[model samples]
Target: EKTVVLITGCSSGIGLSLAVRLASDPAKTYKVYATMRNLAKKERLLDCVKGLHKDTLDILQMDVTDQRSVLDARQRVGEKRVDILVCNAGVGLMGPLEAQSLDTMRQILEVNLLGTISTIQAFLPGMKTQGHGRILVTGSLGGLQGLPFNEVYCASKFAVEGVCESLAILLQHFNIHVSLIECGPVNTNFLDNLQAAEPGSSGEQVDARTQSLYEMYLQHCGTVFQNAAQDTDDIVKIYLEAIQSASPAFRYYTNSALLPITSPKTAASDGLQYIKTMSKIIFSTNNKVEQK
Candidate 1:
């Protein structure tokens, strides 16, 4: 009996690679369903699989935010209780937080957070009835640290991290497992998908108020963005391990640079704290000079 695995956001990037890699393993006994928003946009994914020369890959349609879509996906998968679910569907919207529309922020949370919840919920009953399953949620390094200019994105991932940790405890009794992949920047189309809610509008944009708080945050950072990226395959490998391992880890960090450093003498050396302390001294000295 082949293990049925479902993955979302398979049009490109990590999701695509994960689906292809899992499906290609002939001895692994996996029936893979690779889902995307527009099944039409999966040409590259299709091409990648074709190059690998395997036919077990099934392309499906799923939009995680919609309960109906999730139900429909369940029906399509049919009879096969999903053995593993990779909640990989997510979007990125970048700009000054003040400029980000309310709808945009909601969209991010909806697709990244609620979407994962819905996907898990949709498949949970089946997995529980079967007495086992693996749930993998794609978290981010941004969730671990407060990165600059990406307030909303970071918030959503942070929420995911929190939720998944709690979920792991909850699912323990059912023999089901939940894992989170706290990844760093992987080379993906996430950077290209960013958009401003309104190019030019006098009226209210959806996320205006949240965007306002975000703008204030950027003013302190002095830089718009940072490039801490690795190849997408590196993260996909972690996802695969979480699925295939007999005893999978609860959390896996893809990029080593982003991992927390703790020495026996002093684990309190947070670089961010040191920078903040210096910033306070510099500002305080400037204030005294102005008074003189």
Candidate 2:
């Protein structure tokens, strides 16, 4: 028997990698429902799974932000029994506070936070009744420590952290394991997907000092992406451990090199030290030096 895995946002990046990894498992352990928002954009995943057992992988359309879309995908699954659910569908937003719009902020909460909530609500009852299931979410280091220009993105992940934490405790009695994969700078389309500062919003609403801060932050992130980003395959390995563990962990951090940034408790209890330290790290000049 194989686990029925339904993963969201599988068009590319970690979602696509994990779906392929599991579906291609030589042991044939997973039957993956690799879902994306648009069926038209699923060519990459189709190309990857070409030789694999067709019965093991199914590509479906699921826009997490839409209730009808999610439910429709659920209906397509037919059995209503999902052994493993990976809530990986989310978007990113960046830029100074003044340059970000209320709409963009709301959209982040919608897709990242509310989408997770809706997916869990729909599937949890079945897991509760079955007394066995694994719920994994793609969390982030931003969930633990706030980033300068990613206020909205971090806020969404922070909320997800709390949601996953609360559910982990609540679901334990039913033997339903909840795990959060806290990622750091993975090689993904995440940066490109970030809602660019609204047209002219950066120039019009953002002040010179804040705009300077935003540009500096982007440069810092670019350096990190170039040097330290984890590959999608690296992340998929951790995902396998989470899925396969009998005693699964609640939170799994993928990038140990980023511990200093993600471990908030390492900072002074007062939080002032964390603020100062993070600001310095975010605005550091070493990235330019490394580039040169």
Candidate 3:
């Protein structure tokens, strides 16, 4: 029997690739319900899966940020059974912390944190009752270690990291597995979405030193992604492994180059040393960025 899968944020990026990859499986092992916030944006997904077997994939409309939409989407799934639930729908917010409005931060939390929870809640009962299920969330390497100028975005992913980890322990008894796909920079529209959030006047009001720090951070960020970012396919492969494993890992890091960002926390007895070390690394990088 094919595993029935429901994946959110499938209009593009890893979600789109994963949906197409599974739906096009030569072995016919996966039946995919690929969902997004708008059906109008589904052209890319349809085009990507064009030559693949059509019967394996169906496009659905669901906004992960909206609980009603989540519940309604679950209802639309055939038999209301979800063998694998991919909580991949999320938005990004990046800018100076002072410039990020409270409302925008809340929106990030709603989609990244609450959205994952709501989606999981909608399908948890079925998974538990069936005696087994897989829950995969697209977390971030940034979630493990905070990055400068990503205060709100990092906070949202950090919360999700906690949620998935806690759920892993709580749901394992039911034979349901929860995994966090801790990703580094991947080529995705997430950056575009992050820039689309409204700006605050702090951009105008901030002093020169603050502005310099932000500019240096952006420059360093551009170089990091350009040099080390993984393609969407790379991440899809990792997710596939998590899906197929009989006993899956709780956390899977997609980018190893960024692993150093997370190591200091555990390397120190109190984590204060970790904080100091990370700060120094960040400032040193920015200093070089400033020289250029």
User: What TM-score would each prediction reach against the true structure?
Assistant: 0.80, 0.94, 0.93
Q: Please report how far candidate 3 places residue 206 from its true position, in Å.
A: 2.0
Residue ranges of candidate 1 with Cα displaced over 4 Å? 51-55, 196-228, 260-292
- Can you give the lDDT of residue 78 in candidate 2? 49
**lDDT tens digits, residues 1-292, model 1?**
7888999989888898888888887585788889988888888887877755354678889989989988888889854689999998888656555556677889899998899889988999999999999998888766765554577887888888888888899899888889988876677777677444454332445467556545554443322225456777888788877777998889888877656322321425555563453334323435456545
Ranking 2 against 3 by lDDT, winner: 2
Stretches of candidate 3 off by over 4 Å are: 196-204, 285-292
Whole-model lDDT, model 3: 0.85
**If both were scored by TM-score, which would come out higher, candidate 2 or candidate 3?**
2
Point out the higher-scoring one by TM-score: 1 or 2: 2
- Residue 190, candidate 2: alpha-carbon lDDT: 85
Q: Rank candidates by TM-score, best first.
A: 2, 3, 1
User: Which candidate comes out best when scored by lDDT?
Assistant: 2
lDDT ranking from best candidate downward? 2, 3, 1
